[model samples]
Target: MPTLEDEIRRLMADETARLHAAPDLAERVMRSSRSKRRRVRVAALATSVAVIAAAPIGYLTVGSVAMTGQEPTISVVPEPPPIDDTPPVPTEPPNLGDLGDGREFGHVRVGYLPERLQWSQRSVDNGDRYSITYNYKGDDKGSYRVQIHMYEEEAVQEVDDQIQAYRGEEDGEGVTVGARSGYLVVQNVGEDGMKGTPTLFLRMGDRQWAEIMFSPVYAEEFSSAEAVDAELKRIGEGLTSTM
Candidate 1:
């Protein structure tokens, strides 16, 4: 008893198999709804009422493209640490190591220096084959640079074995500068702890010797290496070098 043109060709083959059509589109729409050609049965009942109103928006757009195949998880928040600005290391060392009756090279009389340093008036005498350099005020690479050399005998253990043949071990000591038994070597260290390069070898006589060089800026104010070996063992015990 189905014949409103067979219930409109079985409701256009169940709305063309609920919109997954195109497999021969429901047998070419049931052969154009068995047309005797009333404009092919009113264009197959207006293409089965537009495929039953687009089968619920084609099943909610294929269930919204299978629930967006997973992609929203973003929560990242990590980046905040860097501001040490560095400026604190003076636990005492600015009495200005007396440079008063000091400052002589050829006849050798090095009083002392280290703070506003001076004498980069630069000097070099051909007598004891002397050398003298001291800088800082206007910065001649100053953080402390005092190069005073006057050797004839030389050997506070050959200046600690020439800084142990250029640093094989590391630290060396024997201080008391002006009163003289100096030999604080340790050059170029910084493996990771950072601080080395003291070099002070003053002897003033087994034939007279002096070589004080300090410019690793005492690791910015002695923290270790035995507080830069007790601050270069009170340098030069007050050297009065005429030797």
Candidate 2:
């Protein structure tokens, strides 16, 4: 048989082992629940932080569109102006008689073709023996006139070149009439029809020359070229022999 003290000691040992085996079970469960709640709170806090970070970017994009209302502005510029054109006219027809007497030693003659046209003769004192003959075919549609000058060979050649350059070669002839040797330049002049006009230039010396010009507006109006030739021949006959 066991003693009473021994049995009491054995029972106390069993109770102590059971208490140790099931120690603070509720407190442990409560602690695990509290830890899970803290972890959830921390996860929520992290999500809230992420939302805060993304909010500013979204707000800025929406704010930019709202502030502008539409699109941005642009500018443009304009242009400038343009320029002019036209030609000049003559004042008066040269006077034949005055030019002859003033330039030539007053050795001049004026005549009409077919005795119908009015003509004049003048001279210019160019320090040389020279004369200018002016034939006026009246101021009308069927009337034309020309001025002729007689001067030195060089002077005559220069004038001839100028005339040739102005009106290209048509017809001409060389002649040694009286004491002068020169050429007669002829052309058909008129916008409507051909009016045969002849311009004569005689080079008498190195410094002396003579010119004869005939311009007919309606050359058909004249009796004949022979008549014009006769007039020119008469004028040639009238040249001064002493120059």
Candidate 3:
């Protein structure tokens, strides 16, 4: 049997050993737990950081792609309308003479002449007649000349023959003059080697004739064969008796 003080000492030693072992075991467990926790925290932080960075990048990339795919719109402008401010001009009928009266015998178109001719009066068959003479200043001043005559006639054939002689053509040939019963007279009497046609208008009683002579040459300058025929027809359409 052991003494009392010795037993007490042995019990105290065993108790101290147990205390030290308990502390070491607790320290080991705490260290393992702390390491595991630290690993989990690190993994979570890395995942969160990756998610935050990729989110902004993905958003910006999508926005850029969408903007790039869109097309720009354009605006169109319209043109203005045109304005008309001019007045309308008056026009006359082709058949009617410029005088516009139905009573006139005929009309004469006088062009720009270097000089005007003097009018002379005479008696033909106890009826008054008019003569007009002018100097044609042209290159062939001597060969080309102009004369106009008006007379009362018992018949128009004689005056027609005279006009034919003047025009250097036989009467009742080349071209006819006037409308209805008028006279066609062509003359080639110019000092300038010029030729012209002077048409004559006659009254119904075979007692009146109006003559018009052109210078330079009617066939070559003042009037063409076709134009003379047309003018004569128009004059005859407006013919009236002056006797």
List of clashing residue pairs for candidate 1: 102-111, 177-235, 177-236, 177-237, 178-236, 178-237, 178-238, 178-239, 179-237, 205-208
lDDT of 2 by residue, 52-163 (tens): 4665332211211122223322222223333445455654443334342322334433332334334343334453334443444445433345444555535556666755
Which portions of model 2 miss their true places by more than 4 Å?
Answer: 1-146, 152-154, 160-170, 188-192, 218-221, 241-243
Could you tell which candidate, 1 or 2, scores higher by lDDT?
1
Q: TM-score: which candidate is best?
A: 2
- TM-scores of all models? 0.24, 0.39, 0.32
**lDDT values of the candidates?**
0.57, 0.51, 0.44
Ranking by lDDT: 1, 2, 3
Writing each residue's lDDT as its tens digit, candidate 1 over 1-243 gives 765756765776787688866556655665765544455545555555555466542221111112223322222234457689899887632222334434754656655565566776555554434566677667654234656666664334555567566455545655565455666776667899656567667667677677766667634665666665555555466567575
TM-score ranking, best first: 2, 3, 1
Q: Model 2 Cα displacement at 64 (Å)?
A: 48
Give me the runs in candidate 1 sitting further than 4 Å from their true place.
Answer: 1-102, 105-107, 110-117, 120-133, 139-142, 147-188, 193-195, 198-202, 207-211, 217-240
Q: Give candidate 2's error at residue 19 in angstroms.
A: 96
